[model samples]
Target: MEQLANVKAYLCAVFGAVVGGIVNLMGGWSEDLTTLLLFMGVDFILGLLIAALWKKSNKSDTGALSSYSAWRGLCRKGVSLLVILIAYRLDVTLGVEYIRSAVIFAFIANEGISILENLGIMGVKYPTALKKALDILTSKAENSESVK
Candidate 1:
């Protein structure tokens, strides 16, 4: 019983430290960001399923699970987080906090669209308006990128 208690305490300490480290490194964490992370995870998992397990049309090789693709997914997710970090730093430097919120909102929208697409590939019929809205948002993003 004493050994078990010691093990639990040690695990709790490690978990607390890791969580604290992430919160500090991210310049603070919020429920919105948490939801975005969850959505991103779901998107990645569904993508893997669509590629490796689902008999879906070959929209691209990304629909098939390969180690190369897995690594690519990891890199993409990492870059997403890095973008958020950069946004937070920008907010700090500019003395304005809106950049982080904007970045998080953009990422959440993108993740939501990816999740919906993944569900569609899995044979779920989503509302037509949802796709249209996503298309509009995507095009707007593209336009903004082109302007930059």
Candidate 2:
């Protein structure tokens, strides 16, 4: 039992170190990055709930939970983080600080909108103005991606 516990602790420490290294590479965990991560988590959970409990996910033909859709969502989030990592590298290379923040903010807005949409699908009411603002932000983000 002690041996097993030691092995578990060792593995956990290794995992933590790897994740920490990746986080350091990706702009070192600013408030913006933290918020973006939080938003992503919330959006993901809400999507799952909409599919599982509400049976209203639009990502599937039957508007139900789908493992493929879930996997794709996780992949998209991973790619978003990779983009942030690239933006951070750009900022470092250019000796500028805003590129990473810009990318993070764009993702934050996108995640926020997704959360709102999931809420809407679950019959939750929110302000129209808020949705419109998020729409505008997401559109700008999309335009920026196209430009780049």
Candidate 3:
């Protein structure tokens, strides 16, 4: 049973990697796909969490599908695009894609964590130890990067 579970986990991870690889291949492995994938991943998780937690709350399609959520989504997209633009231009002027990629990765990680937390709020139990570890990891990473 343990072996079977391990195999299943491995297969899932492999499959996800393959799909992500193809997406990167087709999308030219640019920052665009990375950011877009991160957004979509978070969006799907958020939707799932909302569905799970508010099954009876008459989830009006307005905010999420058309109004507030939609607006917020657009704004996030704009902000992401602006950040990417700034990073790209800075890289072009300074000749350093590394800096550009770092900036984008920071934004992506921040957004990803928030999405995961939102999902957890919807009844998904994140182990306290795991959460604390991630918090420490994130803090260290941010601090290290900012200090340099």
The prediction achieving the highest lDDT against the true structure is 2
Per residue, candidate 2 scores C-alpha lDDT tens digits across 1-63 of 999999999999999999999999997978988888899999999998988998888899998
Better of 1 and 2 by lDDT: 2
Which runs in model 2 stand beyond 4 Å of their true positions?
127-148
Q: Which pairs clash in the backbone of model 1?
A: 51-63
**Candidate closer to the true structure by lDDT (higher is better), 2 or 3:** 2
Backbone clashes, candidate 2? 0
What's the lDDT for all of these models?
0.77, 0.88, 0.59
Highest TM-score: which candidate? 2
How far off is residue 141 in model 2, in Å? 7.1
Clashing pairs in model 2, backbone N/Cα/C closer than 3 A = none
Per-residue alpha-carbon lDDT of candidate 3 for residues 1-148, written as tens digits (9 for 90 to 100): 9999999999999999987765443423575446656665666557544645454212445323334554565577666656656666666788755545555556655665766666565666766776565466456547646765
Q: Give the per-residue Cα lDDT of candidate 3 at 3.
A: 100
**Cα-based RMSD of the predictions, in order?**
3.9, 3.0, 10.0
Question: How many angstroms is residue 49 displaced in model 1 relative to the true structure, after the best TM-score fit?
Answer: 1.4
